[model samples]
Target: MFKVIAVAGSPRREGNSATLLKAALAGATAAGAQAEVVYLNDLSFRGCQGCQPCTADDTCRVQDELTPVLGRLRQADVWLLGAPIYFDGVSGQMKLFFDRLHHLTNEAGQLRKMLPGRRAAAIVVTYEDKPRDDYREVAQRLANYLGWMGRFDPVEVVSLGRLGPSDAAAARPELLAEARALGQRLVEQLAQQGRTDG
Candidate 1:
């Protein structure tokens, strides 16, 4: 079975980003992939301290709750990252988790592309304002970063907007459907590339 990691970066346990991420995981599971959801809020960890300990050993030296999670990333076939928008970018939790991914680089100070072979990734962002072309840039930025890590395909970056404060994304069937489609599409891409080695 293919392994997928769905990361939810929203502080709210049941917020829009989390709901959408769950929907994507559901789709991935239905497609016969082993999918797991990781909530950054639930993990007790600090951001990358810039000490670059990973440069020497390719591992984060802080050794908090995220250490095991980082280990899982190396084995996952796909990554689905979802976060809420804060100040026109991903939430602080998401940014910090991403920063820690420096461990994916080699000692030569170049990206090691953590996961093996031709991998896949998806990025989802939820915003309170209306959807704008530029709003997708945040997701695109992460996608580009992942691409540089050797997952060169264009990531299935998704942007959701105008979600009400108390409205779980389930109320927005369209968005939920889109999230599902994105998940299924990601799996299809992986299968096409024959990277379902798990």
Candidate 2:
């Protein structure tokens, strides 16, 4: 069975980003994949210290609430990352979590230690009434980072705009449906690749 991990970067548990992530996880679960969601706001963790220990050992030395999360990310076959745009970027929690991912590559900037052939989805929620190119670019940049660091292939991006209210995503069935479909597609693609490999 494939394991899927969803990380929620919003401080609000029922916020738009977390709501979309939950919907996606539901789809993955229905598709016969084991899914789990991690709420960053609930966890107490610090940002990466930039000690560069990972340069030689290829591991994050700072042990905290995020340690186990990093471990699970390495073992999971699929990743779903959701974050709300805070001041034109990902939330502080998400940005800190991303900073620790430096261990995925070596000091030479070459891809070093990461699971190969995995899949990922970048979910970004913004409060802007009209989605800006910069917002989409943020999601795309996140997708690119996951692809480069985790060796995820075909990283899908889901960008939602005009979500000023915490329940905005919950109120929109179509948005939830879209997220669910994306999750299903990820699992289906993985299964197809497994069959092809076999």
lDDT comparing candidate 2 with the true structure: 0.81
Compared with the true structure, all predictions reach lDDT values of 0.82, 0.81
Candidate 2 lDDT, tens digit per residue, 11-33? Answer: 98998999999988898898999
Off by over 4 Å in 2: 107-109, 195-198
Clashes of 2: 0
Worst 10 residues of 2 by lDDT: 113-122
For each candidate, what TM-score against the reference? 0.92, 0.92
The list of candidate 1 runs beyond 4 A from truth reads: 152-154, 196-198
Residue 182 lDDT in candidate 2 = 80
- Model 1 clash count equals 0
Clashing residue pairs in candidate 2 are none
